[model samples]
Target: MLDELRNDPVILSYLQERANLTKGKIAEKLNIDTDIHTVCVHHFDYIDTLRMMMFYLFQQIGLNVVFYIPFNPNAPDVYKTWREIYERVSGCDYSRWECVESSQPNRGTKFAQYLDKCFPHQEDQLDNIRFLSFNHPTEFKEYLQKNPIVNNQNEVIASYEKDLNIYTDCTKSDHFYASRYGKFFLSLQNCKKTEDGIFLTYDDYVNMMTSGWVQYGSINGTQALTLLVDLRDYMDGVESFQNIMERLQSLVYLQEVSQVFDEVAKEQAGRHRLKCYLSNPFRCFPYVHQSRYQITVKQLIECTKDLARKVNRLLLAEREKKNVQLYLRELYKIYLTVKDKWEPSAKQKIEKLFSIHIPDHWEFAKEELYQLLTFYLGSTEEQENKILNFDQLIGKTLSAENIHVTGLSFKTFPWKTPELPSLLTHTWLKECIRCSFIATNQNIRINALLVDYYSRNVTRSTALYSIYHLLAYGNGQITFSYIKDLQENDGPSIYFMILEELYNKEKVNLEEQTEEFSWEETVTTQEEIPKEPLRNIPDLLWLDSDFCQRKFFLNAFVEHHPVYENDFHQQQAFSIIGKLLAEQGEGEELFRETMFPLFPQWTNAHKQNLLDTSYSSGLRTYK
Candidate 1:
């Protein structure tokens, strides 16, 4: 690559200009100019995945990321695939990144790589040199136990004396939200006993390997997170991974039985010390919740930063490229408006965090998030820069562009599924609860969930708004993709009808709703549709679960786990109740008993009319 570059006219001209400029500058600084010099970047190209791009941006961490997949010597690894690809594509031998037993890791200091920072070797810098490495969690934990480096610097004890490393922010002003996870691991080095006792539950596990514990983790939107875990996540009323994301909450203090150090949380000895070793935590964890506070300001900031990246991408697309300067100016104005509105209060809150200082520098991170917005606005200059992205600034002015929107499919895009579908129709399930039965966890919850999903807002204008606004981002021909026909018995998403309502119009003013959707017409049109149609598109799922591994694991666990005969009784309740409800028979008494709490005025008359055979079947389905 260097040989080819050296021969290129572009390189020659650039090098010659740099040489002449450097010579003149050096001559002026000194007495006379005798020799010419060449100037070029000492750093190599930092090739990395798109996932790592955003953080490299705000944190300004100078990391030359290289992708490496180590081979498993005993079994097949990525080494074989790369070798075959190289042989087939380029017909060359590929020998990089093979992990043979004899091939030892580079045990040199990581600071050794940074020439500008560590090369000159200022005596003060030499004493404080930190080597941060990105390594597997198992290897990192092993280094902490075995490596003789007791280099505890501030909040992190990075692996400086050897090959493994725990990543830390170079700038103290920016606190990597994930750093707290390392501290929790670091805290394990000390056995801090708690008299109050730790949270213990049935067959619990502190699920690390979460994106937060990962070093050089996936950069994809589906797997990345700015914050490792939210301690105050319990406050959320919604059903999210927070309900099951016990990354830290599951930590338990335990002592080994018979000195094996493999005892689970259930096993313990009287008057024994808490085991804080990594090796001890297969069945027992070392640390427990020390203190609780209604605090997660850092978390909030990190969440906001993540949201800002999303909003920034949208606005960048919306930018008027015909007048780039004016577009940036307008965006800056809006940014300033938000900053001005939120700044004073945010400053006070941050100041309060700084003033009330705690050990481990919990809130010691300086006010640096504002710089993110500053960087965002300043990035307009480097529109071609990957992080900033080319905001249509580099494209040909004469070229035609088309804006295409996809995933206009039903509930997939806007995702307006009822917030609490079980509550909507399963009010009757409370009777089973009164009889000491928990209906919420039963399979019958799906009867309401599925029904609520089908009859979900045909009136929701979000689909129209999103499509129009997203298209407004581009000054070009607009087109969209939609699932016009549902698979087999299913009909197209109800959103299709909602979108069609807008498409038939001559003009749409979102502020003006000309008329409400005619339910009679919608039902009449659906009369010829097949029965038991699918509501959602189905596919095999694994990695792309919106980074919620807990949900994925739990879902698969529930499906594959062996079921008792009695469990099937509750599971079949959904089909039975759904059949009776559509027939408008038998379950009127159940609804009266269960739903009276919600609507005490409702009576059997409501149910009889609801189930009336006189009504059209299609109309009854919508009802």
Candidate 2:
């Protein structure tokens, strides 16, 4: 029968012609077994392209085919034939049969009102023709046989109504009526009243399936319970079905939804289920896409944890690969630079060059130093940690001035260099002794030994000279005061006491010399002057001196000042000399500490002839 329908030109033509009309109405009256031979394709709108493909496949596979056209509006005497079919087959139900219209008028127009006010003019003409055509039974029979046309007497299904098998007694089971009656009840309630009739439509059928009406059997507890449980089970299945249906609906509405939502959902679900094992680039764990996950919530959490570990491992491997590549490039450059000149003996030289001796007090071992250097190299990452550890061990040790040496003898000093002569490298004759005084981190502790003699009324020059002599020969670290308590009973001698302890360790013989300076001992240069009584001295000076001797002691005092104060004194003294130089104006050479000529040359006449007198500026006196 399927082959017959496919090959039959008459049936194909009819099917093709009526394709535009709603298949529901056509299939309703047609005496056709829909399961055996399909006349109307279900969901054809969605699968038109698919159907075309299938049609070609069938053709390729040698199936008989024809293009169908059943309900052609331009057929000969279509209005007459349609009216006859509607009147007889539709059983005078004008609501069920649509009127044959020609040149439909717009609503609210005079022609539309006229057409709507009375019946269609085409309908009268159709009715007249229908009466004439079907008047003879022989002609109608011929029409049915020749046209493969369905006629009035054929047993057809009623599209609109279902017969309810009403149970007079409540015990009779009724599934269809229970399912459908609620829809009918609601439809009757919702429909607008019209003078002609009720338009009980297909939307009412859809409401029966979707609304909660079909959920219950009856008011009786037993039936209601059974019905509800079944409905619930059915609804659960229906919900899953609804998901698929909604996705399909989206395809129809794709133009409106932008298609991305469907793509995203599909991609998410697909990627989730796809399992993969990783391959290298690196010998690490597999990296999988998390979006394609389809596991349950608990499983998803576990999967995420696993994925994180895998991703971390992969990242580590990639980092190693990058490091290897970088190393390889560096190795190639090294090969280019040193390949020909490289020697096995060079290893010893390289090792020796890199070796360094850490200070005795410093606590780092060789391995520790290597680690420290490694940490320094890793300054790209753990810089703060490295710096913190380094600070903990050393913490600016060189920043101190009064560094008291304890273990090493003052006599055993580090290597002395002529290039950099310093009292620090000089060894005292005994164990730890007085060292040159410098700032202990710039926190001043005034040494009283330098000023003790001055306080006792010894000459300032003599005291200063002694202090300078001690500083130039001293060794080890010097200890001194950081604060001066002028109000203390110690009388500013505490700083000096600290120095005296260092001086005692140095084996210095501070025996006083009773003999005064002789002319030969005092005079070393042509410009030397004789010492005189030092008047206007506070109860501090123990000697008298001329300007030259006083100036020599002052210069010594400047050098013996604490190291930290050196910069300060230098700046202050320079400022004073600079002012003096500026007053003197431009000259042949600039003034400096040692090289510059001091005093102005003066030509003087005593009685008959003028003579040149040489005088020196006292700038070096404060050096």
Best by TM-score: 1
TM-score of 1: 0.19
Alpha-carbon shift of residue 591 in model 1 (angstroms):
4.5
Considering summed lDDT, which 10 consecutive residues are worst modelled in model 1?
Answer: 382-391
The TM-scores of all predictions, comma-separated, are: 0.19, 0.12
> Candidate 2: global Cα-lDDT?
0.27
lDDT top scorer:
1
Error of 2 at 37 (Å): 16
User: 396, model 1: CA deviation in Å?
Assistant: 42
Candidate 1: which stretches are off by over 4 Å? Answer: 1-22, 26-35, 39-139, 142-623
Query: How good is model 2 by TM-score?
Result: 0.12
How much lDDT does candidate 1 score?
Answer: 0.29
Residue pairs in candidate 1 whose N, alpha carbon or C atoms collide under 3 angstroms: 51-219, 133-165
